[model samples]
Target: MEELIKRVEELEKNTQKSSRERELLLNRICELEDLVEDLTLQLKKSKKTIRTPVAPKESLAINNASKKTNAQEDEPWLFYCPKNKPYEEILRNLDFSEGYEITSSALVSEEALWTQILEKMNEEEIPKKLTALRKLVSVQLSSACHHELLIIVRGIPGNENPLFQLILPHIATLAEYVNIAWSEVENSNPELLGRIALVLECEQDLKVLSVDRGDTRLSLYVEKLL
Candidate 1:
């Protein structure tokens, strides 16, 4: 009877020990699960933080470039009469060069030049848009009795002014661009529609060169583009 009692006590102690061990193991498993959840949450937060700045930073560049390339697409130059920009327009206002302004035919804008360049090309591709930009033939006509038109068409490096990015490298190819300028001038001024006289700018003086189309034609002795 004593031996049976001892066996019972031993069995009870072993069962208690096993129960404590199981409880400890369960606690450990719960701790591991909590750690895994915390780690997963941290990983998600980290991904969000990384994407916030990186994505917009890349997209901003493309957005700016597209805006610049396609700026004032609905307006094209008819005729800008200014031979030189005003002091306030030129002097330290480099911003004036990039942020071009345009106004409708009812009136002109602060930056009236861009209005004459591009007019409605939302469907054009980038290269075609640039081609349209390069094809600008600047012709300035005076309203006086003397019908003299100044043609200022040249392709400058894109850095100086984004607008006048011309491509006339050789002197021989000048007449083609001149014809383009002539057409623009004719359309703008109805008086010079029939014909005009060429008062060529020679040195500091004006020299008259005759070209007949019914009236007088004025040709400027164009200087070497600096």
Candidate 2:
């Protein structure tokens, strides 16, 4: 009988030990699962951080090149026309009937001048087109007036002085972009002259050339780009 009792006690102790070991194994398994979850989260976060920088770096490189190219383009020679009365409307109504005969030696036909101006205006860039247009006008005016062809500005003064000098490398840089100039535009639209006046009034950097500041406010000239 004592042997049987001893056997029963030993069996109970073994069962208790087995139970404890099973509980410990379960706790360890739980700990391992938690560790796996934490590792997975960390990996996802690391992947996100790694991917963030590459895209911006390429974008920055491209932007720098574009900016550099833009910086190299030519700037316009701004000239201030001094006149008590704004000649914006008058300039628009100029009849090229007399033709460009400002010089005694030669005469330039209006059709020839118009053809040249139109060719120059046929540019992809709006600023280049405008610059070309301004140049053409300057050429015609210089020829018509019998003066050394210089930069020209014909516009009415605005009510308020310009606060900031806007240097538009392209017409795209302007507040408004108008792809409205061509041979037809010059022929029918007298407002074309007013368009230039509008640009002068709106943008800055039209540098006034050192020309004769006379009573006649018909045109303004500069010896060279200041």
In order, candidate lDDTs are 0.31, 0.31
- Compose the digit string of candidate 1's lDDT tens values, residues 174-219: 3323344545544565344322111111122212122222333323
Tell me the lDDT of model 2 at 124. Answer: 23
Error of 2 at 101 (Å): 99
Model 1 RMSD vs true structure: 33.1
lDDT of 2 at 81: 32
Q: What is the lDDT of residue 184 in candidate 2?
A: 29
Clashes per candidate (backbone, < 3 Å): 15, 4
Candidate 2, residues 16-52, lDDT tens digits: the string is: 7975675465556556766898999998888745444
